[model samples]
Target: MKGPPMPAPLSRREFIATSAAAATLATIPVVHAGGSDLLRVGLIGCGRRGTGAATQALHADRNVRLVAMGDAFEDRLEESLATLLRDKEVADKVDVKKENRFVGFDACEKVLASGVDVVLLTTPPHFRPLHLEAAVKAGKHIFAEKPVAVDAPGVRSVLESCELARKKNLSVVSGLCLRYDWGFRETVKRLHDGAIGKIVALRANDYRGSNWGKARQKGWTDMEYQMRNWYNFTWLSGDFNVEQHVHFLDVCAWVMKDRYPTSAMGLGGRQARTGPEFGHIYDHFSVVYEYDDGTQLISNCRQQPGCKNNISGHVYGAKGH
Candidate 1:
């Protein structure tokens, strides 16, 4: 006997329109309407952000259930599960049995095969491309976090996976939260509506202090320590530029009507955090991106401690100051 018919893939125009309209939290699940009423959601990272995304997913729809979880470290997975269980709002929705709790490097694969309709890809940016491809191939809806990859190749892989997901009629939502924020949306809309005429230049900056670091234990290998403190490693977190400053870059792109940059020159260095424990990622970055129309985006980001903190962006136009 034949199973249910597959849904028609969205046209390019339809996909663009749907993505734009569903930029906010209220409309995220609207794309998954074709799924079963009771959606079985899986968490793949089990970190702080992973746990938070799982919580949000549970709250996004009443019928959604957290059925499976995976993480490289068993402790992280168990910690996240316990935290979810304690939350009154989504506690009842958490039903990850012991068998469904997977650990180690292959945990993502295990979670994908455990009968989940949706999966949250909150692993480090390094693992995102691999996990995204697997999820798309497995025909599961995905909610992937920002800076989906560590390098150009990884980014290309994510693009390919997204296109394939489109062909499969699977919903793939990104974690660029600014796009979903009401205030930022309104502001960007006004800019695009000519509140600022003929944009000429923009400035984006994200300056902050050092992030948390875990000291290496006696028996931990290099791989174990780096994995535990993934944010400090270039291969894992993709540095603060791709990992954290991506939000500002996204905003710049939005203001430019999604135009691609023609060329860019950047300067960065590791000054404050030079210890071995901090890995090899740079602490600061400044880049100037030029568009074909001569519009420029000057961006800067830093992760140093005990310094003045400033995070803001500005757009310059012919009619505005």
Candidate 2:
């Protein structure tokens, strides 16, 4: 029997075009800063994810200040700066001097050069590898959101970068927030202590909400807007399964103490949100992952409205002890 055909590779031009477009749509306006003597923090992307992350980082420590920001679009950088300075919680924590705001492709470089100790990489998955590589090279601790890469090539790059991060003793944490949750940790600990004697299989599910949707706006090129709203693109978001449900997949992997799955067979499609702007991502998916020891991990995810937010998983053991 023959195997499934591989996806066609994206040309360099296609990649650049999509990235450029997304950068423009997602740009935020910048705000002016107040002072110095603050622990400088740089944000590489200014989307909702990036803004939320900046707020959290500020709240995490008093010394930390959002000293610099970078985005492909000037508008996004400015908008993000304005929001941060306006939010009562974030405003007090940010120092948005003219010298601290940066815009354009090279803005990331400038932010790093400005003496940032920690960097937040919340760019689209397609651009994550590049941003992560730069942060690692600059010897800065990093907080990168989930779905680190969009494709096999990008994943390989991230793994290699992860290696360098370990060597540098940099605290490189993925945005898999569940790993930090107390309730989840308690359950995992019991299982490890023989609460489940010799695990055999596991199953996980994430069925909630509708896929991404965007309204048209002026000065936004198709490529730029496409990149700005990347959750719908496979090459940028790595498919809904990998992008959103990977948290459950990662949980199963963590419990089993494994990295790669032995083999996988799955099905996916676009049951809803079928539009030109919506690229080649499946709105629903089911995958079965088999481990070397014959243990199996089944994962399913769907993005349809009116569905309850139910994310749960269970591990089965031989003895059921």
Candidate 3:
């Protein structure tokens, strides 16, 4: 279906002004552009990744400011703000008086309502759909991290939100930053130019050390702990396969210029880290995806320390390697 109509493009000056305003409010503490200048930014999650993302966004352009911060945990929000404030570059751009930091489940909405022009959705994959929907409804541009969703339902929601974003003329940049890298872009161009002939098969592997975190304390609700230790939960992380390995999956698809695989089968299970606190996620996974032309794509990923960190993807064509 056709998506919503795109919003009018912002003038260069307007864009700069909005970005600068956002930077001031978010606590980057940089010099303000001028009167009527502001690009307010809101952060939805306050985890390490989320805080890191906020740093990048603030540094992406001088015109942007982080004006609002929100998270379920007050400690996370405070820690993120402190870290941002500690950085001179970020501190100089942030407006201490105007910035509105919030906590609790509904804090996201408060941030949005506080006149943020850009929203950074760094929450867990499971909550991505809800956040995206809210941002789209508010007509705000978004910078959402990878693995947009953890399930079919969430995927459908994001797809719909993408449409709304298009209609609103909003820029929705995914966290698939590799796609923006110079080398990857050049490789994709070459593949599209038939530098790799008609691709027949592919293999990709992401082998690395474990990325496990301590479990939550007793008496915490499932939702609370799940949010804190999100990487360990299937519903929140979509497993290591879709969560971390999806990069390789995306790379293969980009090289082949295809999105859908006819069918997929895989086997995965948690071996080293065995405990109820670990949630339902496999520490190792190997999957085979078949395309319409009978082309096969094999992908394997493992999360165990001491293993080599090798990320390689190969494509086989009719002309042979």
| Top lDDT hit | 1
Better of 2 and 3 by lDDT: 3
Candidate 3 similarity to native, TM-score: 0.87
In terms of TM-score, the best-performing candidate is 1
Residue 159, model 3: Cα distance from true site in angstroms? 0.8
lDDT tens digits by residue: candidate 1, 13-44: 35333522344222434334434456788999
* CA lDDT, candidate 3, residue 130: 91
Task: State the RMSD for candidate 3.
Answer: 6.5
User: Which window of 10 residues has the lowest lDDT sum in candidate 2?
Assistant: 20-29
lDDT values, one for every candidate? 0.86, 0.75, 0.77
Query: For residues 1-321, could you state the per-residue lDDT of candidate 3 as single tens digits?
Result: 243343454553444334212122123334457645566778899888788888887785577778888888889888888898998877765653435878898988888898888788888788888999898899887888888999899999999998877777776767766676557767777777888688889998998887876577988887888878888888889988889888988888888775668899989878876776667778899889999879899999998776678877887887765
Give the TM-score of each candidate: 0.90, 0.84, 0.87
For candidate 1, the TM-score is 0.90
Per-residue lDDT of model 2, residues 195-268, tens digit only: 87998889999988787666557898878777767787777788788888989888897788655678999988
Q: Give all candidate RMSDs, comma-separated.
A: 6.9, 11.9, 6.5
List the candidates ranked by lDDT, beginning with the highest. Answer: 1, 3, 2
Quality of model 2 by C-alpha lDDT: 0.75
Q: What total of clashing residue pairs does each candidate reach?
A: 0, 19, 36
